[model samples]
Target: MAARRPARAAAANGEVRTGGSGRSDRRAELLRIAAGLFATRGYKQTTVRDIADEAGILSGSLYHHFSSKEEMLDEILRDFLGRLLERFTAIEEQGRDPKQVLDQLIEHSFATIHETPEAVALYQNESGALSGQPGFAYVDQLGRKIEEIWIRALTAGQKSGVFRDDVDAGMTYRFIRDTVWCAVRWYRPRGRFRHEAVAEQYLRVLYGGLVTE
Candidate 1:
């Protein structure tokens, strides 16, 4: 599934939205350029000048949209994680059986990896160090909330006999979480297997043991 882009042009709290079409498009384009650079180059290594150079704009023009490179990073991560958390929370709230919920969650994750590999990679790369940094504590808090949803589903499945009771829920959750998210390392968006195919095969292996009866 293609990742949805947030509308960065809108204003809340009675703040007026002002920008011509050209400026808005350029702003979005600059963000795209920045995200790509941040994902490919480490965020700290990527300077505002780098972003401006990639966008073919001067640093002054780049600053007109974002106060600093940190602002750009914050906007990218915030939007990426915010959208991800919202989707996962919605899946949890649908009240499906644990197995179904887990299936959807796993599938959605693969799709996310396919659609927003850059964002996924960025989070994986920067989140640990950012945890101790001020103003970025929400990174860890949001991560914990996401972890809880997955663990809850796993526990529910175990209790309902749909999953094994032998494994600890927390450990199992960590294993599954790492396995799914780490695919961003090698997963190519245009690879031979599409995200849906990858998800289906993974689910097959997950639900059925490797040993054939």
Candidate 2:
């Protein structure tokens, strides 16, 4: 499921249609800039002035829409987590075999890494820090909830005799989790391997197994 960790990385960075025109569009653009900054730099370390400077605007202008830096962080994280949950929910509801669902989930994850590398990296770094902290509660909840989703998918496949039942679902999920998302550390959007191709290779190896069939 790879849900969003509550931080200042907004999914709106990926979803916002910026080539248009409006004040709302401008606000979205500002948020996107803030999200990227917050994701790259730690949210706590990023100041409202930093975001405003990045956007080439005054801090007061930045505050016109959002009350404070914390408020912006909250919006970004909420949007990111909310969108990720919706995506995983759709994947869950979509009629696919467990293997296929797992495939889509992994591929989508790579795409997410490609599209929102900063957010993915931010989640990787700050999830531990944000856990159980005030005003970042959804970060913890969404994480557990997303983990359950992945476990269910894996366990369901094992029960259906599609995947090998010998491996523990939790262990398998952790392996996949560590292997795939951690790639964001080295992956560049314009790097040698693209998200889709990397996903295909990973899937081929994952489903086919190391030993020859």
Candidate 3:
């Protein structure tokens, strides 16, 4: 399912309503707090009260924005994966060649880890378990869709002689995907190497083999 945007609640005066923006901002903040807790504590271990306490609000007050903890989890995953897929799709569409497409994919992925480490960690740790759960069909669906985009780029590269043809595209894709996404565990936003630098170094090693030619 698509992520639902928070609607502006109408006031009795119908003057676009007071505090609408504040409520939306609060809702986003609550999601961020919940995502961090969920990433570190495990989803099943995190309680609604934990999120509320972190947000400095009463449990009941949290309900004013999100109906339940599950709702918040769903929204977080949906937004994260939805935006990721959208950006990747755009890169593929606009890229001039298969190599260029793959390059941007790797770069954007590192950027995502830098910008939203919690969301990246949460998805990496939880997605496999959530794939078969009810109401999480989109997890698998969108995941496969994202995987296909990468595979397309890799296979196209091989076909066009831009990449080695003997290597299995599926295996190559898995190697690159795991190597890129798993960096979330150790990557730090304030680390000596920024996301762009990390991407550049990775791409250098990836395209230019260590063995002297």
Candidate 4:
């Protein structure tokens, strides 16, 4: 997933809402702050008060926006995964070829990391612990859907000879998935290489052999 872009200005009322109207802008800000905290501090270690303090609001004020820290987590993950799956599905449906689809997928994955590093990191850190937890089933369900899209691209490429046939598509997809998403740990918005440059260089190595021809 990508890092979230910067939050916009909040409403004058100083309240954030998770399920209501008129405060979406402030609500997004609170989610951003909470995602940062959850990514840096373990979810188990983070408190609603911590999120409230970061937002410069009282804990009670935070509750007006979210019923609990868990709700915030759920909302963040659902939004992140939902957007990602929607984009990936569209890429697969509309791409000209398997190679094009795969390239867009890789590029988009990097872009996601750049845009929503906090959410990406939060998912990476907490997904395992969240497995089978009540009210978190969608975490794994959406993950499988996302995985299927990648694997389908890989399979299509191999069948069309755009990718090597000897390699297992499942294994190749796993390698690519891990290599791309794990970049969240070191990728910086102001780093030496921007996400586009990183994706370009990765695609170069991925499609071309490391050895001189």
Number of the top TM-score candidate: 3
TM-score against truth, every candidate: 0.89, 0.84, 0.91, 0.89
List all candidate RMSDs to the true structure.
4.0, 4.8, 3.7, 5.3
1-213: candidate 4 lDDT, tens digit per residue: 322311321222234324446577777899999999999998989999899999999999987666678878887897898899889999999999999999999999999999999999999999999999987887898999999999998899888988899988989898888999999999999999999999999999888859887
Q: lDDT ranking from best to worst?
A: 3, 4, 1, 2
Please provide, for model 3 over 88-117, each residue's C-alpha lDDT reduced to its tens digit, 9 standing for 90 to 100: 999999999999999999999999999999
lDDT of 1 by residue, 24-120 (tens): 6666677678878888898999998999988888889886776678767776677777787888888988957999889999999999999888889
**Local distance difference test, candidate 3:** 0.88
Q: lDDT at 52 for candidate 3? A: 92
- Model 2 segments beyond 4 Å from truth? 1-21, 209-213
Write the candidate numbers in order of decreasing TM-score: 3, 4, 1, 2
Q: Which stretches of candidate 1 lie over 4 Å from their true place?
A: 1-16, 20-22
| Stretches of model 4 off by over 4 angstroms after superposition | 1-22
Reference-based lDDT, each prediction: 0.80, 0.78, 0.88, 0.87
lDDT of 2 by residue, 117-213 (tens): 7667777877788888898888888877777778889999999999999999999999998999899888889988899999999999998878986
Which residue pairs collide, candidate 3?
none
